[model samples]
Target: MPDKKLQLDIRIIKFQDLIGRKPDKPFGYYGLGVQYMLSGKPNMADKLFTQALNIKPGYMPAILGKLEVLLAEKKLVSAARLYQKNRDLFSGKKIYKTRVQRITGSLYSGKFFYYYLKSIRSVFVFNETIGALQRMFNADRGNPVVNLLLAMFFLKEHKENERAFILYNLCVNMEGVPDKLRWDLVKVLAKDNPDILIDEKTAALFTTIPEGAVGEPYANFILKQFILLKDTDKINQAFAEFQKNHSFPDPKTMWQYIEFCRENDIWDSTVFACCQKLIDYGWIDRTIAETIVGLKNRKIIEYTRGMDKILSLYGYI
Candidate 1:
């Protein structure tokens, strides 16, 4: 995911340039107002929206944009007043009327505004603007989107739990799936929440490998879903099929690779091949020679005799 703060700054700069170039046009001001609203700055956004409306009084985008800022600031009374004042304006066009109805709903429910800002894919401090997302979740316990949002916020706050996985999970917003949190979520699901079937959206997360990573964070997860087949032969076939696309991205060191194999009870040529590919992949920071002889762990090393043959080639005991 892109850096939200940085993306906001870039948009502000772009709109400022547009304003500089076309001060009399409402479009520039309207656009700038939107950027400010998303970054949790309702006051600045409101002023810019006003400038846009001042330039073109009938401009529907600016009209709606200003309403959004009002909503964002939780100035529901002011928003209501502004909304009713423009009631005729909304009735003037089918699209305009639809937009007005949406905004009007926000006056009575924070859920409306939450969905509103979410529809636009902008930054929204829903916790500050409307109320805590948890409150939204509490009120609308059956809403999958809100459930997902609450989980994302929890993940953002470093609160991982099985409840998140159990929710009728749609694709989680990538922004919420922090790299540090990925392993925990994956492990929790893979090890603890076996009943929670992995959704495609959740499984797609495994492919986001960070460069030069030191452990196989995603080693054997592709085969996790196969565990439900309840047949070793079918599970093995699934593993073989999965290997066609997946490679071990973690196991940053030989010891990690060895440990991974031991944990999975996978002592086979495929394991050695993956280990070789890691070295040949030229991604690890250390040379193959250093890795071969690096940090000898006798217990982990004893997992396979192939470890001895490989280490002996590098004159490592």
Candidate 2:
């Protein structure tokens, strides 16, 4: 019997090869059309996509591909028609029903984008735009994208654990998600739930690339950001893998990380090491160093002062 993995790879390659054979078949044109569009060659993509439709009118992939191109070109009404056409062509297969559900769900999520897009149209309408996003988020509870978007909104609003809770569940169930994005979810979850335990084996999936494996760039960034959030043991493990796969950090981004650590009260030897590199680069002056130390000490002093006032008021000062 043929090796299953090799057979699968061969089938994918054959499909890829079918895309540009002479006297172009609709399947070939449609396949190459999608590939071109995703590769950012809109003109070539449009030619192939249109050719696919000409070969087989009402072909769903052809219509969807052309609509994607039209949307990128800002032809929203035309794109909407094509999107509708794609839905109408479905024959009620489970896959078709799932696609329809996902599309409708995306449109609901797009309402947030719509309001955001309009906020750019006029400064006076900015608050209305935000209100629209909030209303839609509250109204739609089943959309994973909406949940993720709301989690991001909560992070902006400083509602910490609420965001973490949504993100943790999202990562556990999501499919077709980019690895880097999954990593980011872990970072936020770890930050808000420092003492909330996670599965060590499942968590280990993120810390290192398997032998002879490479990583998605976003995946590396996710691990780096997560390492920035983790306890010493996890941080050390993540750091080793991060250094193995990526280059040294740029001075500016390093300083920004240091600033984030300080803001979140997450400072450690890694942060000091990053700061030391900045000091060596003359990016940090002694005055700035002293200011950082003073600000931290000031927060401690203010807390102490508040306690003293409370004690005095209670006759225990």
Candidate 3:
């Protein structure tokens, strides 16, 4: 049997070929084009996507696919033109506006950034996204979503630690950002930028900020609490309480657990737990797992070795 990746590629190729000849159903063409793109055959995918648009001039998925391909290729101007062309198609303009908003939306940006990094290999594009977010921040300083997106962009680009902290704090303090996203900022900052720990002054600034503050003042307080306490057990317990009392823990919570294990030199158990979680989520990647495992200390190795048996007993491996 072919490996999973190879089989996926074959299926994508077959889907593209089937749709290319028919050209009757816009969805088939769109789906096929996306499949081809996922399989790394963007040239063929672009042709199929264009064919879909020609068959159904106002179709969305195909147009978006074409724009994505252009963006992936670093043809930003072309992508912008395509977006503009299709921007007026939907009735009442609400539908089109909503689509644009969704794509550019703060909630969507984090997931978009992840896929953007995966799809494009160019550091230039990454830098451009960060720059765009920065410009947006300057113009709309009160926009919480923009602030959150900017923070995420900086994190992705490995920018100066202070910039990340500022962005993160803005997101956390910002009003009207769903509690879920604010929690995500906390997890990301805690794990990735622990070295740039929050200080008392920062905490105080957040406290005095009003409730309707676009960005809240509580973020620094939270960070300061973490720093001064320096109690990992307390932090974890608090996180557990937050998760239990509030809404469901998002993906970031899981990431925080993995990161916490890493920061305290608990590699083996961390890797094992991370591996088990990834496997459960169907995201197991041997190469990534092996690299993380290899980076652990001796004690971690021993602890993880014991965890291996525990996972096996539970059939989690």
Q: How many backbone clashes does candidate 2 have?
A: 0
lDDT of 3 by residue, 229-255 (tens): 455654444444443444222333444
| Better by TM-score, candidate 2 or 1 | 2
Q: What are the runs in model 2 whose C-alpha is more than 4 Å off?
A: 1-25, 42-136, 148-168, 171-173, 194-197, 200-317
**Per-candidate clashes, comma-separated:** 4, 0, 6
- Angstrom error at residue 63, model 2: 7.5
Q: TM-score of each candidate?
A: 0.35, 0.37, 0.37
Compared with the true structure, the alpha-carbon lDDT of candidate 2 equals 0.51
Worst lDDT 10-window in candidate 3: 205-214
Better of 1 and 3 by TM-score: 3
TM-score of 2: 0.37
Give residue 214's lDDT in candidate 3 (0 to 100).
19
What is candidate 2's lDDT per residue for 1-317, written digit by digit as tens? 78765665565456568864544578878776666665667777788878888888887777656755764554433444454445446433445434433432233233445554554667545545445544544664444433444454454455656634764555433443333434444555666655322433334434343222234343344344554554445445544554676543556545655565565666455665565566556565443364345444655222335433433454443
CA error at residue 157 for candidate 3, angstroms? 7.0
Model 1 misplaced stretches (Cα beyond 4 Å): 1-14, 20-27, 30-42, 49-135, 138-145, 152-184, 195-201, 205-207, 210-317
C-alpha RMSD of candidate 2: 17.5
Candidate 3 regions exceeding 4 Å error are 13-21, 77-85, 88-317
